[model samples]
Target: MKKLIIVFGIIALTLVSCKNGDENNADKKTAVRKKVPVRKEPKNVSYTLESAKEWLKKNKSKQNLKISLAVNRTDKENFAKMDSVIIPTDLSGDIVFYLPFPLQVDFLQNVDKIILFSYPTQAFAVYENGILIRTGPTNMGKAKDPTPTGLFFTNWKAEETTSTFNDEWELKWNFNIENKKGVGFHQYELPGYPASHSCMRLQEKDAKFLYEWADQWVLADDENVKFKGTPVVVFGSYDFDAPKPWLQLIKNPKALAIPESEIKEIIMPYLSTILKEQEKRKKT
Candidate 1:
């Protein structure tokens, strides 16, 4: 009888151990089945005026765009300057027209914004994700004082500032690109050719628009910026021997239209560097 009792006790102990083991295994399985939360990034909602035009053409709607205020008189005049006239309405309820050539740029995915000043074309373009958002005629540095080509960044900006070369010359919406050189983009006279003293001369409206739209570098000290500003690529060269290219626009406006392939070629060289800088900025 004692032997029987012993056997029954052992069986009971074995059963309890197996039950605890099963419970532990079930707990681990429940832990493994738990779902992990995922983080999502914000969607890119910004659209270019060109995209909006095509959308309206196909899916016609009474969707009135919330146009902002006119950048300046020159910006207003630029509407009459280009090929297609798709006017934008401003914040003050003013409708301003601008003509921009269709540019299908698809490669600048790493960039948020880029300013391209082409000396050969005598024009400046503002791009977002490779899409041409805005472009306008520019009077870059003359043959005597040609604007330096290569990659640059927006330094500091001033709403109203005097020219470092001549205090008598008042510049509006001045955004400096080079620190040592007193070269920048600002509202100045455009004589239909390369005229500025190494500056990118733009219309008053373009200057104001860029001033408000562009991101400026934080001044680290008197001479340097804490972080880099927006990228500006000044490429190509003007043939001082020949007449200004835009003069042909009188005969055919499309004459001045830059080929998409050419623009792509200009940006391709600096893209890798720009992307690297952008990544570094994001970390900081």
Candidate 2:
């Protein structure tokens, strides 16, 4: 009887030891499963004075570097003060990346050509078949003489024309949108802010490019337009009291990221009218 009782005790001890070992193994497996690598999110790079200098040095040899720098600076005067200028990190990239305009707009796919002048951003973008083709800086109306905002068609163009506001001021590559208001876009001085006499100002290169690109209205009579030319949408209000909008880019890289939805919204109101005119042009 004593031997049988001893054997039972030993068996019970072995079973408990095996159970403890199994529990330890399970704990080890749990720890192994927890040692996984995690993915990290990308951080946005901020612009700095040093980076701007480096960028300038790198692109100094570029042909359009001066114009690119001027546009980034928001004016020729600001560009002159390059030491203090804060520019986008991707300054060396395509101009589209820095400008506040979508690369592609779905709604504009059917439209042949359109031009947009953003008052607040002080920029102009040209879209051909919903794809952004070109963009550049613009110095628009002064606070006292603000550029009129609305839909207008290109009326007439001249390689060089005198400003109606001031005959002495010779405007180059001029394209008139509003004959009554004498409002047009042409090559003029960009003081780095809105200093125009209620007219849109562009760099000489941009002015010449647009001169050749935009079409003039087909006039049936002296005052009557038979077929309208390219559509021009001038929208938004500038805050003269506020500092330059591009300055905010120093803090946020996406400060000027104009949302695709916003572009769609802006165009929706005039989409029908633009399409009707486009169809009329096609027929002619």
Candidate 3:
């Protein structure tokens, strides 16, 4: 009977030891979990036009000024002359963050180069290997002369070219996509709206950036294009009747947000065509 009691006591001690070990392990796991830091989302703050200017004044820097001007769809010269400007309060000090385009596009991973112009947001984004390299504001065609939405390749380019519509108006960093229609993107005035005459208007710096980055079509003859240049997708439509989309940011920070899925949807129809062109370019 004494032997049986000793065995029972030993078993009880073993079970208690096992229980203590489990409790200690659970405590260790809880402590590890506590040590792990949680990520916090950025606060989206709204600002009035006056408050925006004040904020710009407080956070004065060349980059900040440039970003502010881009957000307002104007250049430094134009922004300086303006009485008030619309500013995104949640500007993370990066122009890329200020714009609505996604940072990475998985669908565009195979694509070497492509430019996207969003008419609704009045912004342009450049993607290389599915990553957003550059983005800025643009003033597309007016309501009466809406910029045609479709896929086009970069064609002829000139440092300084005379506008076909107006002899007096000189277009700088001019890149013509549609020779017949006289449609192209160039350095021009951005009145914070769609004021261009059926062409995409950009800031001087943005125009120059694209001029150097984008490739021009290789010509077989004067009229025929043997090899196409970089692909440009111009999509969506602006609401001329409604207030400017950027202004809506004052109420809703995500008012102009363009989802990655929507961007994928926009590029889906042209994926085959884009791939075919890419393959042909590789061979050439």
Candidate 4:
């Protein structure tokens, strides 16, 4: 009987020890969860047409005069109805947009000449050795036939060219980027939207300037063209269904300017290639 009693006592003690250990483990787990920090997202800023107009009017003199350029491109007749469109914010919480607002041009410098086009902003900028010499608005390919994104060298140019798709369409100051598909930049209509047929449509003056400024691909005596011309980087996407992003400038003028760090990130991918092309150009 005494032996039986002692065995029961040992089993009971073992059970009690295991229960205490389990409780200690649970407490540790809870403590660890409490110590973990929670990540908080940025606060969303909202806007309305009346609010944007009011903001624009109040700070007219304090900001850059061209800050309103993006919104100005929008159809004023129907702009007020687009008040619900949200202004985008970047990873750093700064307003992210592209308009003719002076581009923060400190990122790229190696190339002799470069053309950077942003779809979101519908804007193109020309740079020489890192300085932003000129910027203008553009109407890119429509949603059905979007302009291709990535690095491309200028292929050839013409003072005037007939559209490959429709001979009736005439393109003035046509600078071809993709010759095979009839894709190029030329002076065309801009209804403040992406309405092109897979080509970039620039203002007449801008198209003329680029035609005269950018070098065309070199051709050998046999007439085979080499990939030797100015580098053009067409990046970013445009949301056609949404109102123009610059309309948000009425809410925050600074939103039209992207942070330079973001610009650096965009150009970093192409820096090595740009350097190689710069070297090749120098030799030629």
TM-score for each of the candidates: 0.62, 0.77, 0.80, 0.65
Q: Write the per-residue lDDT of candidate 1 for residues 15-105, one digit (tens) a residue.
A: 0000001111222211112222232222321212333234335542222321211111123333334333222322222121122233445
The true-versus-predicted C-alpha distance at residue 147 of model 1, in Å, is 0.5
List, residue by residue over 1-284, the lDDT tens digit for candidate 3: 00011111122111000000111122221111112123223365454574444555687777767777777777766676667777656655567767788877766666788999999999999988777888999999898888889888887677876543455677788776665565778888777889887888999989999999998877676445678888999999999999778877777767788888898888887866776677778787
Decoy 1 TM-score against native: 0.62
Error of 4 at 81 (Å): 16
List candidate 3 segments past 4 Å from native. Answer: 1-46, 51-60, 90-92
The better-scoring model by lDDT among 2 and 3 is 3
lDDT of each: 0.57, 0.67, 0.72, 0.58
Question: Among these predicted structures, which one has the highest TM-score?
Answer: 3
Q: Which model, 3 or 4, shows the larger lDDT? A: 3
Output the TM-score of candidate 4: 0.65
Model 3 weakest 10-residue run by lDDT: 13-22
Q: What is candidate 4's lDDT per residue for 1-284, written digit by digit as tens?
A: 00001111122111000000111222221111112123333365333343444444454442222323233343322223333323223222221233442333444544568888888878788877555666677778888888888777886566865554565677788776664455678887666668787778776778899999998776653345444678888888987888766665656755656455665667777766765666666677
Better of 2 and 3 by TM-score: 3
Q: Candidate 2 clashing pairs?
A: 75-192
A best-first ranking of the candidates according to their TM-score comes to 3, 2, 4, 1
Task: Give residue 196's lDDT in candidate 2 (0 to 100).
Answer: 80
